[model samples]
Target: MGKLTGFIDYKRENKEERDPAQRIQDWQEYDAPFSDEVLSRQGARCMDCGTPFCQMGEEIHGATSGCPIYNLIPEWNDLVYKGQWKEALNRLMKTNNFPEFTGRVCPAPCEGSCTVAINDPAVTIKSIERTIIDKGFENGWITPRVPKERTGKTVAIIGSGPAGLAAADQLNQAGHTVTVYERDDRAGGLLTYGIPNMKLEKDVVERRIRLLEQEGIDFILNTEVGKDISAEELKHTYDAVLLCTGAQKQRDLVIEGREADGVHFAMDYLKGSTKKLLGSEVDGEQSIDAEGKDVIVIGGGDTGADCIATALRQNCKSIVQFGKHPKLPLVRTEANMWPQYPNVFSIEYAHKEATAKFGEDPRQYSIQTKRFVKDEQGNLKELHTVEMEKVQDENGQMAYREIPGTEKVWPAQLVFIAIGFEGPEQEVLDSFGVETFNQKADAKYGKFETSEANVFAAGDARRGQSLIVWAINEGRELAHKVDEHLMGSTVLPSYLEV
Candidate 1:
């Protein structure tokens, strides 16, 4: 620790955010920058715990605690406190290849597991991480670290999302010839399109992609393997093939009138918004406009929240978010003790913006959509829903029961289904002759290997859709596995070895 009593001297301070009403007018990030002194003070708040759980990266009760990448939290916090910005950035980059992405989008499970959080507020670890990386870029400290030697072994990776990008970055560092294939017109899979610019600006993603390109990793965009290029072609071309194709098959709302117009998947709506912002599409051409329409977003996860934020920015008339499950407790319960991911209610930035604009929270918990009402022209007009109550079934499993007289309908011209994905699309898996462990899109691979000989799988394609941090962790670990498989040895550090 930099100072023995640093924690006692400094109280926790988070970064200031733009007012909800003002920030919703534009798509820029809502957080305002903090000065070096304030960030250093925030870093000083890290207590000298003999065993820092902040970096443990352990899964407690089926949820992640601490950082999934096992970032060197204490080390960087100390370095920052000692005015060692470059050294802190070096330590941060040691484990995480994309701190900027995680710092912006990650829910920061590390803070939930922080020892200091047992009583008082946890250190602003995510903000400090973002500051370290942003400073590195601002000072030109972050440049292309081109490998001194090439292994001459070629590898092809599918999908350009977080997991795919992380694997590409690590494999390139290992001196292997890496070429990443993306299905989209651009390189970043979800980062460039799925996420709104309000959360993560596109240029931020492009900045890192430019750095990766400088490091000798090749990127082929608008190419979908198994369709444009056959799986056998990739298998014969490269020494080894890794599938980082994300779980993108959206779960559909199978109900009456689901085929009505204006019913859309959350990703399609979100992707359309980004594409329009980038000028890829003109007005009245494939644009999912929420303007002046009663919008209903189904699902209660981060994707659903993003839908709410997007609708607000488009100036939707009214917005209502429906969650299948009951609302979580305001505080952590005994089952969710310290050092575990808390199952408590939180009003994220989008929710706050909705509250500010509508004069109340837009979330309607414990509600299930029964059917989509449509007019004669097959346009969506309203939604029928039923309230539900949670109860324990005979097998001791939790289940939802509909309330007898809670049926209701709301006017909704536009509906976005933000429910989570089931798994990766099966076409890509079947193309490679890969078998799934279960009924989902998850490939049956131990660690990350698939049924095929030299083919591998990682990230959401293998483990199902998860957090961006988990995707990075999977990518880094999978890279080490692929490197070892190719050369019979690898110098790359294994995140799980710790």
Candidate 2:
């Protein structure tokens, strides 16, 4: 530990964001940079508990808690507190290959499970982590590390998302020749296209890609497996093939007038917005402008919240959110007490911006979208919805039941279905003869081994849609398994220590 009494003497601090009114005018990052001294103080708040639940990738109340990659949180926190930034960076990179991405986008489950959070506020773990990495980059501490020798074994990985990148990083460290194939014009998968640039800047992703290129990892852009190249061809040419394709199939809304012109999937909207911000200059053609439209986003998840924020940037006239579940309590209830990731209310940055502008919370809980009402031009005009009550279905599964008297229509020019993803896009999987473990598709997970003997899978493709941290963890773990399958043994580190 850096200081014996650091936890008691120091208080937690977070990096402040820019003024909402000013930030909404542009698509740039809004977080104000904090000084090194303030970040060091935040790091010192780590209590360094004996059991250190922060580093333990535990499952509480059926939800994964703590760091999924098993990040050495306390160790790095101490290193940062002691002003040994280089060492802190090294310790952090030991488990997580991309702290820069997770430090920005992760919900910080570690903070939720922090020992200090039982009564007081949790240590500013995410802010401290971001600072350590940003400082590392500014100080020229991060550099490419090319492998000493080549193992003469080549691997082909599909998808350039976090999982695919993590797998490639690990296999390359073991001296294997790794090549990643991406369908998009650029690499980084969702990190590049799906997520809005305000949350994770495109330049941040480009910098890391540059380093990976310098380290000799081959990235093939605009090359899709099932379309341009055959999956069988990839399997024949490489010693091993790892499928890291993420789940991209959007869970759809089946309702009246669903095929209207003004309705779109959340991914389509997010992808278009990011492309526009990155100078694709196609927003005018593909972008749905909320400038003079009343927008109602269906589903109140991260993606939905992002849609709201993006709409605000476009100067939307009005906005409201629909959440199927009841509002969460301010604190954990008896059912979600301790160690578990509490299902509680959180005003995310996007929600905060919307509320500030709209003069009320933009979300409506326990509400379900029933249908889309379209104008004479076949454009979506309004959302017909009703309040819902949860009840058991015929299969003994919990499902939403619409309340009879709560039916109402809200004006909406643009409707975004942000329900969630179903599973991996099945085109490549079916063509490759890979069986998915998930029922939604034909591919199988867990063994990760596909229908073919040498084919393996990981990330959202195999495990279904999840957080960036979990995807990285799955990628790192699968690399070890694939390495052993190819070479009979390996030296790549496993993120899951247990």
Candidate 3:
């Protein structure tokens, strides 16, 4: 707990984001760091409400609340308030393996569930967390701690995303020889390519990868499991295997003019952009060119927001994003209460930059794309859309209804579909020969074991597309399960179980 009545005395303040106009010019991070004094004040905002839900890390009515990794938020907040940076870092690292990643990209569900948020603004937990970890690294408190002894057990983790990396870190620390296989040249999968650098700098991801490598985790990059290396081969080689390839099979728009030259998947567009920015070979993939072109991104989610930001960085002439759902209320509605991640309206970094430059928000809510229009040469020219309204059906179930006479067309030279992913790559899943249903790996929830012996799955592969925090949670849980299988009841931490 922080100072008594600190939530009442000190107002909630977050680290300021760099100017939208300036930040749009480069791929560097836009968030400014909070000083120690400011971090302490923000930490003081954590109320000493006997039952601290900020660390509950549970779901209510299918909505996430608090820190998924079960971070000891209050303890660290109190430590930060008392200027105990080292102790705060220790407590923070006990649950979270990569606060830097979560600090930047996590939606901070913990803040939404904070007791103070029920009345006043929530504590700046994300900022305080980032400060604790960053300061630890700055002061040389974070160093590689290679395992003292080897368990003679080997684990092969597929993918280098949050889930794979977290599992690898935990297993390697448990004295298990861990080798991570990544299809990309770099180790961080989503962190390196899926997410744009402005929101989360590649350097931050690379720093953590370096630390993991120093901690004795082997990384075999540019090697696809189903292609470069066979699944059977890996299962026979490693004592255990964990699949964390993620739900990467992107959903497609199957409307008219589907094969327009300019229409592209949002993930491919982002991957190509990051590859070009990092001077990596695109391998003949079509790269995005939004300069002087009108860009339209379908699907109003974080991926869509990233597309808007990426297009802005390329100086797109105009940008608009479409969402099927209605605009969220300015404040929490009756159905959307305090504990769940607030389903309320909040401007993202890209929205700010777009508004600053375009004079209005780039989002169009309650809209549905009818089809894509094409030009003479088969390139994208325009997009047909219609407005949608909420209406109850005969059974009293809420559904979307298209409003007639509201059909419209918008000029679009480039179209990016950010409709999200479907599931893991079918080829990889088939190669593993694991049971699957509804596009998810069929594995035991608590143990993460697949049908095949010594084989397991976790994260997006097991569950569908989910949050990075959830991915980390699954990875840690899988590590515990694999360790238990190998050593007959292990000591790995499974926070979700707690």
Q: Rank the candidates by lDDT, best first.
A: 3, 1, 2
Candidate 1 lDDT, tens digit per residue, 377-440?
A: 9999999999999999999998999999999989999999999898889999899999963322
Steric overlap count per candidate: 0, 8, 0
TM-score of each: 0.96, 0.95, 0.98
Per-candidate Cα lDDT values, in order, are: 0.90, 0.84, 0.90
Output the number of the TM-score-best candidate. 3
For model 2, residues 185-271, the per-residue Cα lDDT tens digits are: 789999988878888889999999999989989999889888899988998999999989999999999888999988889888888
1 against 3, candidate with superior TM-score: 3
Which window of ten consecutive residues has the lowest lDDT sum in model 2?
A: 437-446
Q: What C-alpha lDDT does candidate 2 achieve relative to the native structure?
A: 0.84
Clashing pairs in 2: 435-443, 435-444, 436-442, 436-443, 436-444, 437-443, 437-444, 437-445
For model 1, what is the error of residue 127's alpha carbon versus the real structure, in angstroms, after optimal superposition? 0.3
TM-score of 2: 0.95
